[model samples]
Target chain A: MELNIYHLYPEHLNLYGDLGNVNCLKRRCLERGIEVNVVNFTDDEKPDLNDGDIFFIGGGSDRAQQLVYKDFLQYKDVLKELIEEGRAVLAVCGGYQLLGTSFIDKQGNNIPGLSILDYESKYTGDKRIIGNIIIETTLNLEPNKLVGFENHGARTYSKYQPLGNVLVGRGNNDDDMKEGIVYKNYIGTYLHGPVLPKNPHLADHLILQALRNKYGDVESLEPLDDEIENKAYEKFIKLYGK
Target chain B: MVNVRSMIALYAGKFSKQVLKLINSSGTALPGKLALRIDNNFLDNIEEKCDTVIMVTGTNGKTTTNNLLNHVIGTRTDKILSNLKGANMIQGIATTYVNNTKDHYDYGIFEVDEGTLRSVTRYVKPDYILVSNFFRDQLDRFGEIDNLVEDVYTTIEKLPESTLILNVDDPLVNKFTQLPNKIIKFGLDLDLDEVQNSSLSMKNCPLCEGKLQYSSHVYGHFGNYECDKCGFKRPNPDFVVSNLEEKASSQMITIDYGDEELVFEYPYTGIYNAYNVLGVFTVCKQLGLSDDEIVSAMGDFSFHLGRMEEMEYKGKIIKVILTKNPIGLTQVINMISNDERSKTVVHILNDNPADGEDISWIWDAYTICEREETVLHYYCSGIRAEDIALKKKYDNVPLDKIKINDNFKEIIDTAIEDDVEIVYVLPTYTAVFETRDYIENVVKSN
Candidate 1:
């Protein structure tokens, strides 16, 4: 079995350790004896999204977001079509803001987003909502509490299917207690402790969904030992799990 | 001359300083904060009685370089004042002056925090301002690197009288142009022959946003480079390192200054320390101190705890290296990877407020590679121990070689279990002091 991972704007939008998603997926696949290929789209390369089973996007600085915006506008439609065809994606922080309708930047500019989902973010808060964040997720996975860190100045509003409800830390906005948005297999989130390494179930879920996209009607993945991962997850749960 | 408000503020601040010292506390910022609270313009009298004042600012190496210069200056004159304990913000700087204002000071040397540079410079006029190289540090507290650079540019550009001692290697620090202030640049000329991992992959020129072309790559966006479109290029540094050899206990740095070749022997061995040494060396030379005197002062000095502190435990060398940000972490990894001694590395990552609550910066750094020859087991220990353990696994380290234990004592004992020559304990800000104290206890007990 093989999986193709498409990474967007690796140079510009590679902030906040978002590569942990790519690493988690690749490790899980390799542990199961599956071949994996990671294809990166830099600012100079023209992206072809068809062959990719899973797409990943990470956060960047405001200046970096502005630089990646030009490419996001060019490929939003193709990516939307791919997501509709069950291509799994995990976008965090600045990448999450970019997938929405529009987002206010650090300099108070209300810049347009790719609008792949019906959501928007505004930079109105005097202080950035930042800290370790834990969420009681809406996903039907076992032990569905996801823990990570959130650091964003903008407040996002999404009425669509949310990835989770905020158990701790400010989520999508300072109000509403909503966290990330989920459309099919596509997850747009603000959790960036990379949001994967410690969340083994979420990482495996994304990997399983991507494998299903490539090889249709695949059975559940062969589980590996997640003792270290579970211990890491439990620490965050104990700290912020109330 | 006799403003009762300023007088009362000074006396109250001095009284608190004594009381705090009597209680055996190192709380350096409180008295200054109290003084500022009592009299809003308490720092307005900063340069009133000082002869030659110098301020140091950067992401890293500010405290070390300030203390290095202070040691060299102390050799010449006893009339000096400094924030030696590294409470280097506006409040701490105010406390230094409050505690030492009884007599006229010849040199009011200070290490100014990068965030509080504008606030400190507004009242205290410096004769020289030394800018060490800027790196990715505490992004949650200080916004973007470009924005911080702009903040520094706007403040130092106005100080036309002060000499700006800058590091020419960092394209970010050297690109500040059209300033009326006298500029002296110091840079490294030799290659380390190891991994040329630039933590920042910024390909564009910092000044014109044009494409920057590098002739030689050192560490992070620090290299000899030129902008192809804007014609901006690396300046010829006033003080240049022609050669540097890292010894067991010391490093011999040879600086090529015109016709004279001066060798400075630093008692420590970190590549970043070479930059710090040069920043202070350039300042001392400009202050008319001879080359030999500067070299002797730097060689005889001792570093504060947790900055690559070496200890012996059961006939094994344990180095306690304090790493705060991504650049520092990458450098520590790079150093351990380059060492030929059989060793173990214990990485302690903490996400406390002091360590910057966001642990995502760890992803920005390059991982260890091809160090299996001398490298042994890796232990990840701290509040966020498993996070770094996951990082190691993702870095392609075999899972069997990586161990995760949040307990410091247990990990340290396990690391020293082997017949390894050295064990390097790399800890984040919050874990550094505890790790150092534990090692001190272990060494004392043994």
Candidate 2:
């Protein structure tokens, strides 16, 4: 089966190598002998979202994120449909903010979000929490906690229940609030790029779920050598594992 | 006749070294805090006395360039005073001055931070400045490449008759050479080893806003190039490295200075280092160093720590390259990516806010890494381990081959045991110091 991944606003919002998210998804699927096609949508080019199986959006600056807001309005309906269809979606940092209801920028101008996720993000009086982040959730089929890095100045608030609980690092809100939104097959968070390299199990869980949803069974997915992955897990457990 | 408080103030300046030693041993959360505080008062007093000072700043090669100039000038005469410890900021510069005899050291051969260069230069009042290159670095803190370039130029405008030494390879830096002053430009000539095409950055010439026509790129923005619209091109350097090639283990850099030609061998790898060495050659030649002295001094030079510093850990030789930005990381990645041997990479991303609040810069680097199959294991550590792991996963690294470790000890241990000839450690600014401390205190001890 072929996996189609759409990377939104690759040029403008990719301030911190957010494109690594697209690279991670592409590499993992290709290794499973799954044909993967990546479509990068930037300033003017509109991508055919119907062809994509998984969708990704990464972080950038406030101005770049504003630019994405303009482009996002054009594809909002398509993105909503994709998420509703149980397609795997991962939005990180600025991408996560863009997927929300609205983002209140530094000047206090609220730029409308795509509203794919239930959360609303705003530039907090204090720069949003930054540093290593740990999230504990049942989203991952495995019992282990989901740990990743968090670097965002925008604070997200939701009147409804948050996506998940913060296990260790800074989450979605300023004060240990919900980290990210997870509903159906969609997963969006403030975690920046390089999230999967440190959390292999999380990557596997996301991939397995995507595979199972698409192929009805994950047996065809062959696991590579686990030495490095296991060592990384053990290190995380030793450092932030409680 | 001095009062107790006055004596205490004088003693504070005298004990700056001891203070730094204490801070280093105390394991304080902010070790540089005390040095910064003490240096502030000391600098306030020195600013009133000194007339002219200058700063040299950049990412990868500032240390070597600053050190080379200091060494060459010091040999001819003890007229220069510099911060040799690679402390390129207000605190480090202040510390260097406080420790030295008051009202001494004619020239301040200090390397300033790219972001802090303008601020520091204002107080230091550098008569001469050398700017290497501007690359995408520390997204959260630095904002963007254009921001840094503007900041440096603003600082340059404030200087009076300052001799600006610039690297023409970077279009951003090349623009500074146009400033009405004694501008000295140095860059690598397009050779066979240089990459033919430019990467994501360096798409346009910063001068003419026109498309840049590149002969070749030594690394990221460092290369020989000419602007199509404007006649701005990489100028021939007074000191040029010709017929540059990597010998078995060392770099064979043949220096061609106007009338004289000298061949020197560097223990460091890559053509980028050849440019760094050439930067030193230009500074030394301008500072009146004999050909023999210049060549001899370079042979003895070695990176102090956390910069291409090679050491054996657990019987495995590991080369540590401090990659604080995209360009620096790309250079190191390009260096090892072409090799056939299986490699293990440890990428540490810190969320110190100072390191940059954004960690998305990893994507630009993953695109340039050549051999994915030969990567035996990729270890992503630090506060942002999961983010890095996710990025690698996005990059198509086999999920099983990649690992995320938050603890430094575990990451270093796992990386050392991985069966690979070359281990590349790319850490941000704060992580560089933290990793260096771990290697010195923990890994090196074992």
Per candidate, the number of residue pairs that clash is 0, 33
* lDDT score, candidate 2, position B348: 85
Give candidate 1's TM-score. 0.93
Error at A118, model 1, angstroms: 2.9
Q: Is the docking of candidate 2 incorrect, acceptable, medium or high quality?
A: acceptable
Instruction: Give the TM-scores of the predictions, in the order they appear.
Output: 0.93, 0.76
Model 1: interface root-mean-square deviation in Å: 2.2
lDDT of 2 by residue, B6-100 (tens): 33544565465576576664222122334445343444434444444556876567876787677666666575667776776666666565555
Question: Just chain B of model 1: what TM-score?
Answer: 0.92
Per-residue lDDT of model 1, residues A1-242, tens digit only: 99888888877776666777787888888899989998987767765788888888987777778778875687889888988887899999899999889987767678898888789998784687878899988998878899998888888988888889998888999779989988899999999887888788888888889888878898898988887778778887886677
Best by DockQ: 1
